[model samples]
Target: MDAYRGFVMLLMAAELLQFHRLHEAFPSSVLWGLLAYHQSHVEWAGCSLHDLIQPSFSFLVGVALPYSLASRLGRGQSLQTQFSHALRRSLILILLGIFLRSTHREQTYFTFEDTLTQIGLGYPFLFLLGTTRPRTQWIALAGILVGYWLLFVLYPAPGPNFAYEAVGVPPDWPEHYTGLAAHFNKNSNAAWAFDRWFLNLFPREKSFLFNGGGYATLSFIPTLGTMLLGLLAGQWLRAGLPARALLRRFLIAGAVGLALGLLLDVTGLCPIVKRIWTPAWVLFSGGWCCWLMALFYGLIDVAGKRRWAFFLTVIGMNSIAIYCLVHLIDQFIINSFHIHLGHGPFQVLGPAYEPLLTGAATLGVFYLILLWMYRRRLFIRI
Candidate 1:
């Protein structure tokens, strides 16, 4: 688990490297281009390494739940006490997401689509589902995914009079779909409409318009579906199947998920959009997540290959701290490096690599901080 998580968090922390700077400096360079592509989002539909970060984090949450619940029960905590702890953690995650988004802003952002906030919104329900039988959990996953898909498909797509510019999506945006698929258009779907009403209930610098990135608060519903996938995976892990059997299960599940997701996208029944967390996306990304779990589990745990995963396990064990550190301290760390080293070392590789150099140093500091916490056994949880 720590190895898988470390891989995800390391990917997140790598955002500091600013590979796009090099890409911009040499747009035709395939190496920089591939790095930049994976580092950034894919505009709307399809997935990127960066896109998987959130779903993986959320999936791990579900994966950890069985172990967590068993541990708590072993300690004699009652259901009520467990629930109270879950509630407390939910609130903290939601507020923390808002607080992070509101940094340098005029007031609280009140956005619920952040990775932390999205997980927080769905977590309690996931906990409830956690206690149910596998059959019940599967049914719940189907209901959530199908119900969310129906809601968007049935919601009327924006008409001609709607102001596209106000929503940060140009009417002529190449990504826009025509026909029934238009129901999933950027900032024009049911989730966006719901946000128009829901976000306004809170204080804001300006009335809640559309998210510039086309993200919506209601994405938590399908995000829960992703977590459910993880939840099921968790149950399988705890069943104590042999390594070969477990490996086969994960691989088959991943293959099925990928096939189903692709079918949905190709038939135009639903689009594979990560920004909106569409049902198709849940299947597609969940497939990838499953394959990843298989890889880490097989290589690190099953094969007893512990030595190489040490780097990732360190960051993974302290996932929450690294999440916050990446957001809250990037600028501080970069500034400190400049103040002490005077940019001399960073500039040695030429001007385009300055951001890369500074970012690598900042990432190093982040690792050191995580290492310190790991050595002290101080993992920051809920």
Candidate 2:
């Protein structure tokens, strides 16, 4: 678990590298292109490694829940106490997400599209689900996906004259704008519609419109489903299944989920969109998450190959600290590097390589801090 969480944090921390700049500098270079593509979010349909960060983080939360509840119970904690802790944690996550979003704004931002906010919104329900039996958990998962899909399908798709241009979708956009697929189109789905009304309820300087990135607050619903997938995996891990059996389960999940997601996308029953957390996407990303859990579990837990993963475990132990640090001080660290290291320190590598050099230096600072925290056992938990 530490290794997996650390791996995800490593991905987040690496964002300081500004791989996109590298891509722009070397559009023809396959290495940069691949790195840039994986590091960035996909526009509408499809997925990317960057996109997996949220799901993996959320999934890890679910993966940890069974153990969390168990630890509390083992300590003879009351149900009420556990419930209160969960509630407190949920509120912190939501407020922290808003606070982070409001970094440069004059007032608090109530956005729910961020990973923390989405997890916060769905966490209480997830806790309730955690108390249920495995069969009940599966039933809840199915209901969320099916119910969310039904809501989108029942809502009428935008008509031909629906003015896709108004929402930044070009009239000739390649994604489908008809049938079931249309129900999940960018900035026109049921989730998007809900945000239009919901976000307006909050005080804002300007009227809320479409999210420029096409994200919706209601994605948390399907995001819950993604966590449920992790909950099942967690339950399995706790079940004391044979190692081979656990591995088999992980592989099967990946195969089934990837296959089903592709099937839905191909058949146009629903599109695989990460922005809105379409049901297909829940299954799609959930599959990859499962495989990742298996791989990391095998290497770190099963095989006992612990030395190489030391750094990842360090970052993972202080995941929240690293997350907040990266968002809060990225620029400060980069500027500090420029100020002390000299502005033209990286010019020898060429003009386009400056960002890469500075980004690498920023990442070095981040890791050193994390290492210091790890040494002192100063993990900052919610």
Candidate 3:
């Protein structure tokens, strides 16, 4: 867990750097690859390492849920109490998501399309659906996936029987189907007209072709399946299975998931577009998520050697807080200041280096704040 956390934190640091254009200055091949691996969000039609990040986070949420809920249940909490607590937590996540979305200067109002909001909206419902019999949960997951597929495939968006070309855009250019949904719904703010238009016209028919519907409602289906997979693993771990047995399970499941995802991709049932959250993408990503959790569980919970994993663990412990802080620091604080490195003693550096210096400075500031919060034991829990 600690190592995983540290890995994610370092990845986050790299992401921050890339986001701020620091990546171009101190361009190490290894760092570039790592950044590329983590930062290259899948273009509409294909999957990439970056696409896995969000789903992985969601998968972790599911992975933790059973353990946390079971811990509460073990303490003799009633089912009603547990359900209510879950709902409250879900609500908090949803509100926090809205808060994040609203923080965007371009957005005029809260929308359910935001990542955190989607998690907030989807997760509790996932949990509720999951708690039922395994068969029922499986059925529900299938129902959603197929239902969503049919909704876009047959009914089409904007209106029933909408023509595909009318909604289509150039293949290589980045597109936003959700933005289109937002536009059609008039949910997007008017400040960003180009973004709004692109988002709204995102194709409905060939979403599986690219980054189509990954963020759309259809994604919840396979995502729920991923959660169920996590639940099964959690149950296995809870059953007092031997460490080797758990490791074997992780390897086997990961292999199966990868294989299945690849098969789906090849067969064209659902091309592996992470943005659209196709079943293939879900299976592949979820498979990786399972293996990662298993690895963390083995090392942290079983092996009991965790000194190096502290950094990421800290970030993970305060994932939401860190996410919000990262955003706030970037959007409002640093950008607003417009502090230049070339002004004084820092004038030794040229214009090209300014971005790097500024990025490092911002990251350093955020890290210090995180360090202080960690020291004060002031962990934010939503």
Candidate with top lDDT is: 1
Model 2 TM-score relative to the real fold: 0.98
The list of candidate 3 runs beyond 4 A from truth reads 2-6, 9-13, 19-34, 104-107, 133-168, 171-214, 332-353
Tens-digit lDDT track for model 1 on 177-197? 777778999999999999999
User: In every candidate, how many clashes are there?
Assistant: 0, 0, 14
Cα lDDT tens digits for candidate 3, 199-276: 445333222222223244334445666566666666666678888888888888888888887886666555565644
Estimate the TM-score of every prediction: 0.98, 0.98, 0.76
Check candidate 2 and list the clashing pairs.
none
Q: How much lDDT does each candidate structure score? A: 0.93, 0.89, 0.59
lDDT of 2 at 139: 94
* Cα-based lDDT at residue 7, candidate 2: 94
Task: Work out how many backbone clashes candidate 3 has.
Answer: 14
